[model samples]
Target: MKRTEKKRKDIIDAAIDEFREQGFLGARTTSIAQKANVSSRTLYNHFESKEALFEAISEIMLEQNRSMQPVAYDPSRDFVEQLKDALWGYISIITEETAIGLNRMVLSELIRDLDRSRKFFTETETHDYPMTQLIGEAMDAGVIRKADPVFATNQLLALAKNFFFWPEFFLGENPTPEGVMDDCIAMFMAHYKTGS
Candidate 1:
């Protein structure tokens, strides 16, 4: 990489760690500069303010999430298996360290800046996301019971969050075990499967 690009990445990496540890308000630009082994002037050259640096970190986290886009639902495949694959793919990403840190970081920001948090939610959140698209497709094909695709999508995602994301985010727990995913999938299928 070019020198400037490497320095930019270094600043972002250091800023992420510092923000994760100290939060947006508590994190110091000087500390981030020290951790990145760059002067405060260099950090400022890359980021006009701490908020700008935080925004860059948020973009990195969002990009990481976008990278794990689930495979499109296949009509020929078993619907239950497809749901499992999709949920697992998403769960893996949310349980990642960076994702969790970003979640916490966003929550911290939300306390101080509701507008920014709402904007972030609208832009970055996966609530009305790819999984929702898959759910809608499955409904159109009659793979699942007749239902509101939006509600059903949220329900299934809630199950995954209940089993995985919430616990890890709130309790510092490990990733949800495969057995938990299996149980959640089975429960979801029981209710949503076309003939169930």
Candidate 2:
């Protein structure tokens, strides 16, 4: 990697650690620069301010989320299996240590800043969510009942979050509770499956 790019990455990496450890309110730019092994001036050159750096970190985290392998609908596969795969794929991404820390950091800050939270969620809502695509495809192929793909996607995600995400995110639960995925899939299929 080029020196400049490496420095920028280093800054982001260090910022993540700093933000995770001390939070946005408590984290300092000088401490981030020291952790990154870059001068405060260089950090300023890359990021105009601490808020800018925090925004960049949020963007990077969302981009990483968008980069997960897209799960396409498969005609030959059972809808339950396909949905399970899609949900698991998403769960795996959010449960990663860095993702958890970043999410916690972002959530904590957003709770204090309603305007920023609104904008952040608006930005998040604009993404072409992968599960929505999969559900839409399944609907098109008659594998599942026709309905609002986005709503269906949200339903599945809500279920997963209740069973798999919230515990892990708030309590550091790991490996997921047994049968949680199956229960989620069953609840989703009960509502959305063909002929339901």
Candidate 3:
């Protein structure tokens, strides 16, 4: 990588550590600069503001977990099986240490800045995620009853969040219970899947 690019990456990496250790509101750019071995001015040269830095950090987080992006829905495939694969992939990504730290930073930001939190949520959850598109396709193929794709998406995601994400985030609870993922898929399909 170019020298400038390396410095820029160092700044973002340091900022993520600072943000996770101290919430975004509590973190200081000077601390990040020191940790990155760059001057505060150099940090500003790369990112104009803390919000911009946070955005960069989010992009890095997404790039690191790009494998979690769901595959395209295949109408010929079993809907429940496809949904399970997609949902489980997402759960695996979010449960990673870096992803959980990012979630904590975002949730902490939410308490202080609703607009920023909303932007983060929209960027991460609504726009890029493939689950909604799959749900919509399932609806079109009559594998699932017609409904608001977003609502169905939320329902499926909420179930996984309740079972695996939120509890682990909030309580440091273990999410390794056997059959939990399968149970969530079964429950969701029972309610949403359509019959002949």
Candidate 4:
């Protein structure tokens, strides 16, 4: 990577740690610059302000996870297996150490800034999420009962997050409990699988 790019990455990494430790309001750019081993001027050259840096971190977090290839729906595959694969992929991404810390920081900030939270959610909302697309295709292929794809997608995610994400997010639990994913899939299939 170019020097500029490496420095920028270092700034972001340091900012993540700072924000995670001190929060958006409490974090200071000077601290972040010092942690990154860059001058304050360099930090500002890369990111104009602390808010800008925070926004950049948020964007990078979303982009890093969204860059994963979308799971394609295969008609010949078992619906449960396909759903399991897609759901696990998502769970893995969100449960990563960095992702969890970033999410905690972002959520805390968003709670105090209603307008920013709205903008963040609006910007991030999309129909192309892997599970959503997989469920839509499954519906079209008669593998699942016809329903609102987004709602079904939420149901699946809610189930998985309750076990895999919320506990970890709130209580710092790591390594999802055994059988949680399978149970989530089975419950979702019970509700949505075609001919169930």
TM-scores of all models?
Answer: 0.85, 0.94, 0.84, 0.92
> 146-192 in candidate 1: lDDT tens per residue?
78877887787888798789888888886667688888777777888
lDDT of 2 at 167: 86
Query: Model 1: which ten-residue window has the lowest total lDDT?
Result: 124-133
Off by over 4 Å in 4: 174-176
Q: Which candidate number would show the highest TM-score if scored against the true structure? A: 2
lDDT of each: 0.81, 0.87, 0.80, 0.87
Please report the TM-score between candidate 3 and the true structure: 0.84
Q: Which residue runs of candidate 3 sit more than 4 Å off their true CA positions?
A: 59-68, 122-128
Which has the better lDDT: candidate 1, or candidate 2? 2
Which of the predicted structures, 1 or 4, would earn the higher lDDT when compared with the native?
4
- On TM-score, the stronger of 2 and 3 is 2
Sort by TM-score, best first: what order?
A: 2, 4, 1, 3
Candidate 3 clashes between residue pairs 3 or more apart in a chain or in different chains? none
Candidate 2 overall Cα lDDT vs. reference? 0.87
Stretches of candidate 1 off by over 4 Å are 125-128, 146-148, 175-177, 190-196
Candidate 2 TM-score, C-alpha based: 0.94
lDDT of 3 by residue, 1-196 (tens): 9999999989988998898888887889999999999999999999998889988877766565554555667978887788888887787788787788777776777778888767766666535455877888888888888898878888888888888898778877765584898888888788886862
Candidate 3 Cα lDDT to native: 0.80
Q: Put down candidate 2 lDDT per residue, 1-196, tens digits, no spaces.
A: 9999999999999998898899889999999999999999999999999999989988987897778766789888887788887788788888888888888888888998999899999988877667888899999998889999888888888888887778888999866775878988888888887887
